[model samples]
Target: MATGDTMQLVHQALRENSLFARLDAADLERVVQMASVRELAEGEALFHEGDLVEHTHVVADGLLRVYQVGPKGSRQLVLHMAGPPESIGEIAVLSERQHYPVTAEAALPSRVVRVPREGILQLMEERPRFTRALLRSVAERQFELLLLLRRVAFFEVQSRLAQYLLEQHATLGPGFPLPTNPELAALLGTVPEIVSRTLSRFYKQGWIRLEDRRVWLENEVTLIAVAKG
Candidate 1:
């Protein structure tokens, strides 16, 4: 895209995004001046956990997956999936953390606006509405992390998988595009073999139908009951 066209898209995204919706014209223009666009191909790592935090990124398009790798390097736990207009690395910037808490990767081809940490800090200091919005966004992300942690601690893998399937069904509809076994396992905090076994069990139980790797919900009530357990 042309530089002018990209800037126009960025301006529109800032206006529409919850984090930047409160920025006035002057502040938005300042941000536009200070930001640079970054493009990522699928499977590209944006930043790894423990890397020094230097910039905050706002997704312009496509998907970014935030995750943490296990100590033994045998497992990956997905923390979140961020889409257009969503901010990444903001918590590190807000807290002035020296290093990133998790790794971010492009789940698909993506574009993100990279704003220098210093510039973002300056804006936060100057814009009260922006500061408030940033705080709220951070708090909500923390809450979601806490909830996921709780489930991982207390829920069985089967129950968690069921819950995840139900969630995907609700969000993406009956003919939901399914993640690969390994990806699904990462999201559910397990290994692929286990995910495959459990999914087969679900299939036999008539909880879901899988065709061409896409899942169709067969019975939501049973899945909900399992999810609650």
Candidate 2:
């Protein structure tokens, strides 16, 4: 059961979300009523990689870190941050195999609004707009995956690192914590030594300013150029 405040938060997050924002008022209300809030402590997993899909989630507060762990126990970070109004496992509602390919864990104390798979599929069948929204989500994810593959195949470490920095700066501002290098390395598909060397090179090139656990952009122009390559 959801508390009044938690319910309110879910309603607002769904309204703001890309997939749900297009829903009509009554349809939105119905979906909200079917939703329940889940609270998670730091490091708690909402689901492990390969878990059978039962529900999708909207982050009502804090960050959800989506990743996969290799057989050798190495983490491959898929998404470092999924915060308010962002969703996970939405496409799984349409998946035939119906297993979440990545694990979603709370990077900090977090709140999630759980939407059951059967209910969302039912809504999709009855609502044309909802179905279209789901299709668009699927298309967007595919496009992003293609881009990721292209980058991994063709882009150099410095280019990818520059792109990553620019993306993080866009999402999290320039001075956010540099707290997790190993996870960052996994996200970049490289080792920490290379990431460190790339950052050192950027520092020498006067493209970035680095402090204890934070970085500030000194030259967006150079970073943008490198990212484009």
Candidate 3:
């Protein structure tokens, strides 16, 4: 895409984002100028956990996954997918920290817009409104992170899986193809084999119907029980 077109897309994405919700047209234009847009192939690493943070990124198109590597070389999935208009690494920037809390990877061929720390600081100096909006954005990101933490900490694997299913069913409706098993596993911070087995169990129990990559819930209540537990 042309640089101008790319920047317009970036501006549009930021406009829809929670952090930039209050930004006016002029402010968005400034952000667009400062932002860098780049495309990443699936499995490409955006940044690693503990890497010095220099910029924040917003997904302009496609899915971005936040995950980390364990000492044993195992991958621990954190944030599954970030759709358009969503920003990442805002927390690191707000805390004035140099390192990232999680590693970011491309879940698909994706477009992302990056805003440098210096750029943000400049914007803050020029516009107090932008500074307030940035702070609000950071706070919202923290709240979102807390929700994910609660989901991972208190819920069992099966329940978490079920809750995920219920959410998809609600969002995508019946007979829609869900994400691949591997994708689901990454989202849940587990392995694909485990996701397959869970799907099998749910299918056999008549709680859901599985066909290839598509999942249909037979009795959402059964999944709800697990989510509630």
**lDDT (C-alpha) at residue 195 in model 3:** 84
What's the lDDT for all of these models?
0.88, 0.84, 0.80
lDDT for each residue of candidate 2 in 170-226, tens digit (9 for 90 to 100): 978978667466667877777788888888999998999898878899999999999
47 Cα displacement, candidate 1 (Å): 1.0
Q: Which candidate's lDDT is highest?
A: 1
| Model 1 C-alpha lDDT per residue in residues 1-229, reported as the tens digit of each score | 8989889878876777787778888888888888888889999999999999999888989899999999898889998989988999889997756999999999899988888899888878888888999999999999989988988999999999988888888898988888888888888878999999999999999989999989998988899999999
lDDT string, candidate 3, 39-138, tens digits: 8999898888889988889898988888766678765766646878788877787675689988888888998889887777777788788788778877
lDDT of model 3 at position 202: 90
Model 3 spans > 4 angstroms off: 125-128
* Candidate 1 lDDT for residue 200: 98
Q: Which has the higher lDDT value, candidate number 2 or candidate number 3?
A: 2
What is the Cα-based lDDT of residue 3 in candidate 2?
79
Ranked candidates, highest TM-score first: 1, 2, 3
- Give the lDDT ranking, best first: 1, 2, 3
Best by TM-score: 1
When 2 and 3 are scored with TM-score, the better candidate is 2
Report the CA-based lDDT of candidate 3 relative to the real structure.
Answer: 0.80
| TM-score of model number 1 | 0.94
